[model samples]
Target: MASSIRDELLKVLIEHQPHFLSGEEISRRVGCSRAAIWKHIEELRHEGYEIEAKPRNGYRLVYRPDRVAPEELAPHLQTKRFGRHIRYEYSTPSTQTLAHQWAREGAPEGAVVIAEEQVQGKGRMGRTWHSPPQTGVWMSLILRPPISLAEASQLTLLASVGVQQGIKRVTGLPIQIKWPNDLLIHGKKVCGILTELRGEQDQIHYMIIGIGINVNTTSEHWPEELKKIATSLAIESGGHLHRATLIAAILKELEEVYQEYLNSGFRVIKSKWEQAAGMLGKTITARTPQGLITGVAERLNESGALLIRTDQGVIPVYSADIDWKEI
Candidate 1:
């Protein structure tokens, strides 16, 4: 396949990094003709890799693409299985859609679908996520955690913790979690998570953790409606961030915490989620199906449900669209 050839060629170039890898030698290693190897090098350049060639010397990789392609991500990606197998796209309707379909087709756990742009990106409560081309992180992580359907919801919290840790390590910024699946900075939205699953009542077949982060997105990129609510790392930090690098960091942190969640259970994930979660031990309102429940946010129960002490006493909120107003 073309992807395999590219991967093989990239491997050859990377192994000989900072050294001149001749076209003939690359072709020999990649099992392609010299002309074919030249074509592949040109394609890598077109994909944003800066490669230099000389008459007698070979090629040297200078820089990689800004997106999530293997040429850019593979070198930096450090997870065991989380991001080892990735499907990179220039554009897609939604990584979640493709990831779900792949999972149904028996894609293994930790298979990731990442896109530079998402035409139909989504957020929680069926809201539209603003995704711009080559400026953010749009990826779906497929996880088949050994947990029951009842416990599957806890993965959302686990993912929240992962994203928080990843963003913190990448940007060195204070990232807060809006209970459920939102990441905020300076009281504005910077990242959003949408968790979906396909499973039986007792067990989970697969879970898709879709995360969208406004990395290098600018205020001009935001629509009028989102101008006030959304923010990007570039806008917040006054410096543009490398999208591929952030994705690599996220996968690394996510895998570490995810493995802990599976072996140690939700106690560790829950504690970290609570430490970073907004509205915890504060007064907030959640619009549940029963009606709007306004209460003092107490703690997250063992099942990852938000327990609020309202006037009527305590209620465990399994699902709700929560808007945290720091009261």
Candidate 2:
């Protein structure tokens, strides 16, 4: 993918950090005119880069923005595919909705849509997700993996494990998975994953994998009833976690784990998911579309279904609102 001229200009500035290069030097390096270089510098300033211009000295990056925008994450991203193309915003109703629309418009695979705040975010069962401004990782990724629709739920499991790994790597906090979607720390919810699909029955078009992690959120940020249930990386670790770093780590881990799955099948991912699940012998009630069912949460079956051993016998739960009410 070809970068915009402004991006090329920003690259030059970042490459010469801590020392200002002349306008003529920048133009020579980027193969653009002095006027074009000045135009790009103004655009970079608008993108939140602190560039200083001197009479003879060129631009130098004093500080970079704390945003998850393409320019912000481009320097930090290590994954070859994920987040290579991004659409970033300050506020939106939902990144997942925007990502789906972008996919329909022929956005490339691994395209990502991220927002600093989500006003109408939702999770499984269409439950509202609290996403205040600049407090969490609210993003969606588009995947065009070579997997069948029957294997869709596995993507959720893969992402859940990826997030757990990423959070652990960044904060050293041991987070656990609560079955299909929720991530728990000290028995409180910290993250959620929502995976949606598109395309014909067999021919896949795209998959939208949405992950929302409460990074810098504090206890006071939660409402009264949610105080005991929802927590954050900052709350768990007692320090502020960089949302961009976590996002990069998540995309990297997700791509790596997913690549492994693509080559070796679901065995490895399923095993990791089970170990991170932390709910094998426990019993709980889950609210499904049919009704509430109580059973001992046994283990993940082959297809990533939650196998609950009830009195009637073992049954596979494909989707549910896991009762975290007591947690």
Candidate 3:
């Protein structure tokens, strides 16, 4: 019936876990009629939560589906503001587009927009992100950082570090951050971060940081062209993963690092980012607007630009497509 009642009922069921909760006890705790409780329980089952009902025993939570919905993530989420307000869509053109719309409409900082699948998922350099249904994490986060417009791009680096740490915490995978906005595992792409902002000369109004992660995807999920370059946590870890748990972990890690970036500066985040960086000290080629330049990857500047030491000199690349095949 009502969302509040459904939430309460689910909360009670989840809190009790394998132990059964009687109908009368659940009704009292959720402040709903037994009939309503039954209706919602059926609904939960329909949504993929397994509930076992015995003759005398009322119900026990058996299993929960791998979903990134607010209710599903509530148990694993620990951030104070990040993910506090979520807009979940079963299917959308793009979470980034929705997040930008919400941010423009004054949505609070830390509001997240998640989609099970993105028909027109956005990616770096005007590319499209592959987001199959129930396969990956396709979501965007709204932030109102106090940083200036020129410094807004740094959030991409910060988010990359946060997401890599979160994934490592969950699966113990050696997720590494490629320069700019890509995450790799076993030298294959697993995640991408895109940070877009609305700001003036010196101030930022808001920002939408879109994060796409390949969690449970497999060989069949990838197109022939992408199979060689893309990968998933399940593929790398040799097991399936719960998408909600990974989302919660990413949100918690992002919020923690974001707060630190605000309190101190980019120095702390920059250092952490370097540790997880995958391209440093390697020979890589960057396709900038000017032309293709190949060189030894040096380090990132304070502004989040990648510095490559070419035969000519050290060049700071603001935006480009990285080709690390040389590495």
Candidate 4:
């Protein structure tokens, strides 16, 4: 199959790095013809790999692509199923849109769809998510967990925890999670998550969780409206980061946390999220469609809804526009 052949080609390149391997030698190792080897090399090149082909030396991997293709990301990913089957796009309208369609078609759990750019990406409450090429992580995860709708919100929380841990692991930047699903570094927004679920009355079908992180984008790359409130990994870390490594780290973390969630409940993940929360126990303003409510963010309910205590009463905020500066 073409997939197996691609995997074999990637394996050869990864194992025999820097050293040039002749087409004849690769063909022998992969049990394919010299022409087949050349075809695979061309395919890899088209996928953004910078492979150098010499007259006699054959192909040498001069540079690895930063894109999150299976060939480039498989070796780095440490997971059983999550992101094991990756659909990577150079640009798309939205990873969420593609993943939703796949999930509807009975895609397996932990399937991942990633894109380098999204022209019409959406966030919570239909807000526009800014996704430029080669600047952010635009990906979606499809989950077919056997849980009730009430329990499904925990997936967003679990994803937020996973992203927080991943960023800390890869970039060593101390980032915090804003309730629901937002990753903040230095009190600015760096990442956002939008979770969509499809199911029957009581039984669940699948959930599509979309995550967008501004990785290498700078202030100038963002529109003037977002530059003041948005920050990227490069700005926070003072260096350019390998996006593939970050994606791998995130998939690993997501797999681990998701396993834990399936075994236990959201208590474990909720505790971790609350610890990393940026506004717990602090007074903040919740801008809801109804009206603005100034309250102290108390804690997360069992179903992962935010509990806000106002002067009048305790309100369970399913979703809200949060301003951390008010805290």
Candidate of highest TM-score? 3
TM per candidate = 0.91, 0.87, 0.96, 0.92
Give the alpha carbon lDDT tens digit for every residue of 95-170 in model 2.
9999999999999988899999999997876788998788999999999989888888898899898878988888
- Write one digit per residue (lDDT tens) for candidate 1, span 1-327: 777778788877766787888888888888988888888888888877789999988787777666678666776788899888888899999999999989999888899999999999988888888899999999999999888888888999999999999999988898889888799988789999999998886988899999999999988998998898888888888897888778989999999999999899999999999999877888889899999999989889999999999999999999897876643
TM-score, candidate number 2: 0.87
lDDT of 2 at 324: 41
**Clashes in model 2: which pairs?**
21-58
Candidate number that wins on lDDT, 1 or 3: 3
The regions of model 1 sitting more than 4 angstroms off are 11-36
Runs in model 3 deviating more than 4 A are none
C-alpha local distance difference test of each model:
0.88, 0.85, 0.91, 0.88
What C-alpha lDDT, on a 0 to 100 scale, does residue 172 get in candidate 3? 97
lDDT by residue (tens digit), candidate 3, 1-327: 498789778878878998999999999999989999999999999999999988788999999887887788777789999999999999999999999999989999999999999999999879999999999999999999988888888898999988988999999998888888799987899999998888887999998999999999997988899999899999999999999889999999999999999999999998998898888999999999999999998899988899999989999999998988624
Candidate 3 clashing pairs, residues 3+ apart or interchain: none
The lDDT ranking, best first, is 3, 4, 1, 2
The residue-by-residue lDDT of candidate 4 on 53-97, one tens digit each, is 898888878887677667678767888999988788989999999
